[model samples]
Target chain A: MLITGIKSRPVYDRLAPMASGLRHLAIAQGSGGQPMLRLLADMTPAQRGVATVVYSSESFTGNSYEAELRAVDGIDLRLCASNVEALQVLDDLLSTAKMGTRLYLAGSEGFIGTAMQRATEYGLDRDEILREHAGSFVRRVWCAHCNAYTENVTQRIFRCPGCGLDLVVRDHYSSRLAAFQGVKADGEVPGELPEIEELDT
Target chain B: MTPTAEPTAFTTDETYTPEGAYTFRNSREGVRRLPFPFPDDEYMYSMNLEPHVPAGDGAMRAAFDIDEHYISECHHRAQMLEAMPGVHYLALPHMMEAQWDLLELIFESYARDYPEHFTLTKTGNEWHWQNRLLGIDDTFTFGDPTTLPLEPMEYATRQAQGEFVVLEERDNDLVIGAGMTTQRADYSLRFNLGMRFFEFHGPVPKLHEMGILDRALKFLLRMKPGHPVRRVNWSLTVNPRLETSVETLPEWAPDRATVDAENAGERVYLRIELQPLHRLPRSNAIVFPVRTYLVSLAELVEHAPDWAKRIHRALASLDPELVDYKGFHRYHAAAVAWLAQHDDGAPLATGYPWAEGGIQPGD
Candidate 1:
């Protein structure tokens, strides 16, 4: 709402080997699935044996790397209809995961964030988890006034379906909320709205 | 902030004595490992600022760190609160939103720091909190107190290493709006709740005259949504109990001030409190988390002879006003002599532990 292409959001890591990891879990969604396949190909045979893949079919552009992911041998792959379901599987996996387990994340900012939220639930430090951002830059926003989550938001300003108020999407992002902030567009001067522009997705 | 660098596990030495299931590891590394509040041997009140845990790790940084003694400390806190039911936890009904804010923040922090042990999830207005460390995973409507086994503040405080107080700012001044502080060094929370900033810290020596509290309040008010500022406060404690606050001052204060030479090292001890003050992002109230630790005077000397000498010098030069305020005037002479006597003829005050190649006495 206040700024554009602020690159102030979290910077992601490229697919690679992480340090001191006894076990590894690679998670992705839709187009993000491609990176998981590449990451698996980079692992040693023994490392591949211990690695697990959690994938979600959800996609903004209808992209899917399912066939390629399934073709990869040795590593285990679990499929889901949505990112939310993938997150559930990740949570269960982390509950039994130990100190030396490493996590790799690739997907939409929203999907990666949702998965990372699960990682945080298991207390994975920065050294223990690496994220590779993929898919669209389209943000998922939470209406500041009504607390309603709007998915796949591509614009800088839009009316919130929850409260019917035109909301200006803020540059800020909350990993805790797993969404961008959407505040009233014309709070200072009622009846006046900010111009609806396309976000730099 | 506690060192985010992963710590090596404790290993016992030859001279170690087992005390109440707590093994005494005679390592200077162990003593230096503790978060000592003083940067210099000479001490004075000032707005000491260090960057609070950076961003995400910062979020996980607790108002109190969970260390090896966490379970016993939690038990001690529970006992303290149970004994003094009136002073343990307090909040005005108007502070409901802030209480919920604090509880949610606690859940978020625990989930981040102990991901293997805790999980917090939200669906609609329903928030589900699972804490393996605390052994309960409950689902409840957000902000509804009746759904939990304990009050939100009490529940959060029980698992914490120390105490937490929330200060609500109004009229450009903060008030002791709510808290679950069962381990106050020497202060009365019951009498201080709702007190303005100036009055709340009135007992702190030289704070007003030196403008430490005023500057600290300004620094605290300037805290942004994500950045948190922290500092360390320290003193001498005569006991190991977590409940050695103002109410129990008489029980131990007399001994701290009047200890004889033979009892000096065994009786008096250093007490350090790692305190972080930051504004809560949602409630806009300030949260003060104090994690307190204690190491005995004799054990400290055994750990590092340089520290013993430095502490002796610091105590000798301590201001008269602060001495009486800290009740150190009671046994400063014996205390200083005991610390110096432990130096064993080494050249005193070469430098700080790190500057002097990390404390050479026990190496």
Candidate 2:
């Protein structure tokens, strides 16, 4: 069984024992980008042999995470730049899996929901996949006045809760794509396929 | 209250150790003695906060006030003792009870004088109030007076058993190393705070080699500074019966030939060392600030596989209240909610060591 979104320790502690019956484990995390890697680093020598893979969405370049990964004895790490890349990696891993494979999804509600949808599309058994979504990630806006990022789901407004900075969520996906395709921000942009990288394959 | 006039001709007892441990003496009847040996050593002392009492006061009131001040002074003495070298003070339950009484008096006085300035709640024998002056709740609890000695070794063991453990100890008065470990993936690297035990006297060499004594001393020194009344000297060593082991990564060596040639048994034993500092004073204070690393039983179970079942069983075997899922969840949630509401400038600390440099979601 593969578990994603494992941010809590209690959940990992509980799952680790039950995981003995399983062969392959894949941990997917969005924030901090290295939950599985951190777990593996702290694991005893006997525990590290359990074929485990970590898929992180956060950027790991030029960070201690790379050094941490090198320090860990036996674990595979896959860094996905965007949700599309993450889905591609998840699809490839699920495609070659047997019918009884279990996938555990953890993290923000939206991220888990997105993974569940992708898993279903990839023909993974619904019963085999467990979803443990704790909280929703409201759009966080950087407040200039308070010098803190604040998000309020109830208000549905982008204002700093700390210092009341009028903020707007900047859409990075389209802008980054435009820059990648050599299209000026003000120019008429050509429709292009969403860039997808198969990480596991 | 204009500093209630100091009673004239207040007969002060010179025997009252400035460390705040004291023996009560009635002027008319001579010294009132207890059955137990009075701890009059330099490490312990007693003081009388109220030097004089009106001659006509009722016996119950006099006893109650005396009890109150004795308890309060014990805390004061403990704080002072923390400043002395090689001396650490843990409060007994009676002392804590007295401190609570004093707090109650202070709260009552505040409510009576400035009713508009605070909110007060009386539930059974306990009174709850908020310091409107600071816009914060008066959440201090003198629930018990018995102060137990903080044991770091026991704490380390518990932490090794997957329980969250934070150790904030100073190193030779130069560096402060605060370690926080939680069962949470994100908080594994942060320093943790938990109940710990340390033997006062043991093989000093073993203790020094284990580094436990140094950590404990640093922890104590950070909590309490040396003062005139209190003096502390601490020496520690690990129990000889406790076997120690070590781990080394030869794979990360400079060359693969050297790494492959290296024997697996070439690991060095982790020798911890200890030393006694004369000026070190012992203190029992929660040095680590409470941050946002609380997890619910349900969340723990979901994230940590079988952690809920194991912790539930363990806590149930020790204290049944810990197994009450709803109660535990409520307590955990309340702590997180409290943290979210309070805007203390300290960053939200996590136990996950790997999340140190990453841009966290809530950041």
TM-score of predicted structure 1: 0.56
lDDT of 1: 0.70
Interface root-mean-square deviation of model 2 in angstroms is 23.4
Off by over 4 Å in 2: A1-17, A32-34, A38-47, A50-52, A57-67, A122-136, A139-155, A158-201, B1-363
Computed on C-alpha atoms, the DockQ of candidate 1 is 0.01
Please provide, for model 1 over B1-363, each residue's C-alpha lDDT reduced to its tens digit, 9 standing for 90 to 100: 344555434231211112332333323444655655444567766676776663222222454355545555666667667767867688866777777777877777767766666798999779888866546778988778898787787777787767889898777788788888877766556545666677556545567677777787887788875677777777775545455554444354445544877788877777777777767876788888887777778877777556776677777778777776665665777788788776554444343232324333342
The Cα error of candidate 2 at residue B295, in Å, is 52
* DockQ agreement of candidate 2 with the native complex: 0.01
The candidate maximizing TM-score is 1
* lDDT of candidate 1 at residue B64, scale 0 to 100: 39
Each model's fraction of native contacts: 0.00, 0.00
Task: Write one digit per residue (lDDT tens) for candidate 1, span A124-195.
Answer: 876788888888898988775566889889998888999897777766565655677676666534565678
List DockQ, one per candidate, in order: 0.01, 0.01
